[model samples]
Target: MRARHGGPAFRRLILEDPACGFDARDARVTHNNPNEEHGRLLEACAAGDHGALQTLYRLEGARLLGVVQRIVQDRALAEDIIHDAFVNIWTKAHTFDAERGSGKTWIFSVARHLALNHVRRQYREVTVDDTTAEQLDAERSLTASAEIEDTFDWQGRGDLDRCLKALEPERRNCLFHAYVDGYSHSEIAERLDRPLGTVKAWIKRSLQSLRECLS
Candidate 1:
């Protein structure tokens, strides 16, 4: 039977097939611990094991596509981004460092950034002509330079910093890009490679989370 997207059948197909090139030992490990499974799969991918990469895709492809689709709001574009994301994961698999973070998080971040970048590029294309865009780029550089100074001088050593630390890294990054960098929602979305709506929600929820944390 053909596996359906995100369906149990798909998972069974991946998990049950030794021909997928994940041996019996790998299957046992995968069944026992999720993080370890992902880490091992990534290592295998780094070693040029295409089957390992396929296994990873079968495990996470649906969710990754969902995440990208939500951000880009276009199924075709999201699918393209997912394809690119997997290509990136395959190419950059050697760069995966378990000491720094989980493989799952790294994978998701790669896909998320791809989706965000695609939308941001599209936004820039329709929003301005070449001359005006160039002017804006120059202005942004100057503004960024000034903001760098301001960010250091302000010193986020207060409760705010502590509170901000309570947020997920992605959400925290969104806040900094929006408030410190003076980026609009679309700009922040572009910068963070998140969906515009997701960026907005992140900023809003981050603010709320910070307030609660401080209070």
Candidate 2:
């Protein structure tokens, strides 16, 4: 099914049985040290190495598809988003700053945001009234202002995971939804059945708490 859209070589690479999906286990085995390997691959990609990009796709493609599929809930749509996300990563490789976060996190963020945008756009198109849509847009702007501008060195902080675990569950859930699920304040509110104002406050406070805890 994926073959019709690519060259013979790509077709061969992607033609594994649809039923068996891409084996993440196999991909992991190919790298003894995943983080270091991914970092090197990103560096190579930044240096204009196409083969590095291909290697990254081979390693992370299946997991990226799995993430998009869970969010978009459609195999075809997920595949399309993954394609776009790869193209994005290729173009934006030079922008990746290792000091900010891990290369793997950046890669997954690219794919996850694309999937989130797709689903959010579809939802807006069908269900939003003009007034509510405008409200949401304004809310998004304000929410962006409140977002933590500096990326934490998440991988370098040994206590980061433990700190996150210490957060109140509601606050932690809000943080995860915002960062991991790519949810807006309004979306988090709806998902958590909390007031929009409350969600926004929780997220703001959570970011501050995380920074303080990690510091």
Candidate 3:
């Protein structure tokens, strides 16, 4: 993705530098014709090109981490998603197709969807009597949208940072609450102590503003 945008991991760890097998640019290069290369890589992987799989992992691991990190939040859980993503990519590479989208996109789509689904499915199974627990529950449910949204930093992604940044921090909070924290409008109103209508307006308008700015 567009880099971690200054997460502690990006700054503090020397090992996390994009050059050390975690470059978003490298991922973007393959993403140029993802479906075509995805097929090649998949075929190679299926045919036992361990190096190809490793290339995929090195190129996308951090970006995928950045994407999944936004939704899953917990460092450990985000890492867990990455772990699962690699396994999933390896096993499901055989099923990939160029007609769907670029292979690189599919790789990320598969990884992110699984991570989002993981949190969403788990969120539905919990009890919710206390407000604290309920918020926690709601937070867990906040995950990746079904599509790979233009929300976070995607390498060479459409210009969205300035738009997302134009919003007030609290207004932005609603976006994260829905996309990252998985809270509903009513839940967000309750949490923020504003009118539900106001919260809803903020989210809708925020999205509109973002789309306009990007467009």
Candidate 4:
């Protein structure tokens, strides 16, 4: 980023500017593209260009909701979480650092972490019995999969999809549970009624297959 106080100079180093006062080397930079478009969006946001935020919301809102809904498992609750996520996005827009992460990634991370935090905090210790867990899991999985495209079909990311294709539809539940439903390994086991060992194997092998395929 490049704005002196606020413009393209800000684009070149807004993350490092004293007024912004954040690090140019914040850790998220390692994970995604920290390009100038993010800087432009942040600038637009700071200038009260609501249209900029709306455009971002339009681009990301459906997928973000899909992700959040998968985790929270309640429509009203997920909507509430999305609402909070947008509020956070608006308030924190000025704090975004192009050197830290891509604006798109940053936006998704905010929404995802909010959903994760809510479910983690509220339902962390609630243990359903084995039989009911399995039934509810089946019903929820079917309902969710039927109506939603949760796994991102992930075009052009290389071997991730190819590896995913290797697994049986049901076995893919392991990845879906973690990536989409935010379930832990134990939760996946309980929900799938597969032994914990089996679920663990599926996920381990699935990741291995993905890595090798990508390689």
- Top of the candidates by lDDT: 2
Model 2, span 1-215: residue lDDT tens:
11112235433554334575544342322545787677777888889887788788988999999878767766766787898999999889988888888888899999999888876765552333544554655656455443232232233455577777666666777776666555666777677656566666677778888788888
Question: For every model shown, what is its TM-score relative to the native structure?
Answer: 0.51, 0.62, 0.50, 0.56
- The collision pairs in model 3 are 2-153, 2-154, 34-102, 34-103, 35-102, 35-103, 142-182
Number of residue pairs clashing in candidate 3, backbone atoms closer than 3 angstroms, sequence gap of 3 or more or interchain = 7
Single out the weakest 10-residue window by summed lDDT for candidate 3: 144-153
* Residue 12 accuracy (lDDT) in model 2: 56
Best by TM-score: 2
Per-residue CA lDDT of candidate 4, range 1-215, in tens?
A: 11111235423542332475423232222223345555666667777877666655665678889988888776666766787898888889988887786787788889989877876665444455655555545644444433323343544664366677766665666787777778766677687656555556568778787778778
Better candidate by TM-score, 2 or 3: 2
Identify the runs in model 4 with alpha carbons over 4 angstroms from their true place: 1-39, 46-48, 94-102, 125-159, 167-170
| Tens-digit lDDT track of model 3 for 69-186 | 8766667667767878888888888788767767787888877786668656544533334445445545433541232233433234435667877786677777777765445566
Q: What is the C-alpha RMSD of each candidate to the true structure, in Å?
A: 12.9, 9.9, 11.2, 14.5
Clashes (N, CA, C under 3 Å) per candidate: 1, 0, 7, 10
**Model 1 bad stretches (over 4 Å):** 1-29, 125-215
Ranking by TM-score: 2, 4, 1, 3
How many angstroms is residue 128 displaced in model 4 relative to the true structure, after the best TM-score fit?
A: 16
TM-score of 3: 0.50
lDDT (tens digit, per residue) of candidate 1 on 116-185: 6655554452343434544545544334322212222333655477676566666666766543333457
